[model samples]
Target: MSIFKPRRKMVVNREVQYDVLMYVGVFIVALFIVQVFTAYLFLDQVQRVVGTMSALEFIARYKISFLVYQIIPVSFSLIVGVYIFNRLTSRIAGPLFNMRRILQKARNGELETAEIKLRENDYFQEEINDINVILKRKSD
Candidate 1:
């Protein structure tokens, strides 16, 4: 008979990760939208002051001008924002993924010592260390 019991399951800590990412994503999107809208409004006002009353008139009057002035920069900035948010979310999810994997091993009795290194100021460090101590004592 096998001495070490297998772990049944371990749930990843999704709530904190999802909530934080959602808030950050929303804030970034809101900021980007606000900036774009503000720029559009400012440009429209400036164009009106300069007698470029209509978008069609303006675009026709200036070849590649509209695209050069607005479309390219906004599109590029939005793409960069998306890439940043993706990386941010991945970073936030990484620790949770590691913790879940370790917990799974612990559950399976494969982890006789829970010696996962946590950050010195990490909020969950205490909990993890406590669990590690308990596991160590139990093993001894």
Candidate 2:
């Protein structure tokens, strides 16, 4: 089953993705802040272990390399997290946005709009099918 359908020309709301993006952005920022904090704390432990190594020496010799290694994983994970959830949330939100249009049309006595089904494998297909049944009853 497909996860995406071509959006209609009549966009009821262009900001359909805004909530997902905001949440994803917030999460990514929080994750990055935490990652940076932990990496520096780990650096402190490293410095303690080095005993005779001055902070300037440690930084000049190893700080950039260590932080790069730490940050690489965090960045990769953040990207993957945003990608996965954006796809997931979009699946739900797109249908909802389209369904709102259909339902609104039905409210104006255009029962034919209820016959429009979402794409295969799209989120909320079953619930929409039930809504179609209700629309059929209302039309009758």
Candidate 3:
């Protein structure tokens, strides 16, 4: 059996934390985008009303265009952030959950319980291995 094992017990907690953080970050970014867009629209409307396409108007127009340019990147960031957070939490939580299930099975005198192998880069590899060691000892 490998030291790295998949986990499954902590699915709920990890997912909750990830969801909360992703929602909060997305909300803040969306709010900022709305505010900037609103300001640009307001200034553009004012300039239009005055019919003065002066330097200030030009600058506003350019900056508004720049903001538009940034929108795609910001949207990309939001999407990527949500995806990465979800993936990270799922990876971590999945292993714990699987390990928990194996432990429970072992407790019921399942000597041939499946081994809990963790990912090499997984954060909880050591813990899972230690637990496995303890189980092995108990089984013997």
Sort order, lDDT high to low = 2, 3, 1
TM-score of each: 0.50, 0.57, 0.51
Checking candidate 2 for backbone clashes, the offending pairs are: none
Say which prediction, candidate 2 or candidate 3, comes out ahead on lDDT: 2
lDDT (Cα atoms) of all candidates against the true structure: 0.65, 0.74, 0.70
Which one is best on TM-score? 2
Please give the ranking of all candidate structures by TM-score, highest first, separated by commas: 2, 3, 1
Per-model tally of clashing residue pairs: 1, 0, 17
lDDT of 3 by residue, 6-87 (tens): 8766654454566666767876787587667766765665565456577787666677655665676567767866786677
Candidate 2 Cα outliers beyond 4 Å, as residue runs? 1-52, 110-113
lDDT of 2 by residue, 14-97 (tens): 444565567678777877886877677677767655778777887787877687767876877778787878776777777888
Against the correct fold, how does model 2 do in TM-score?
0.57
Question: What overall lDDT, based on C-alpha atoms, would model 2 receive against the true structure?
Answer: 0.74
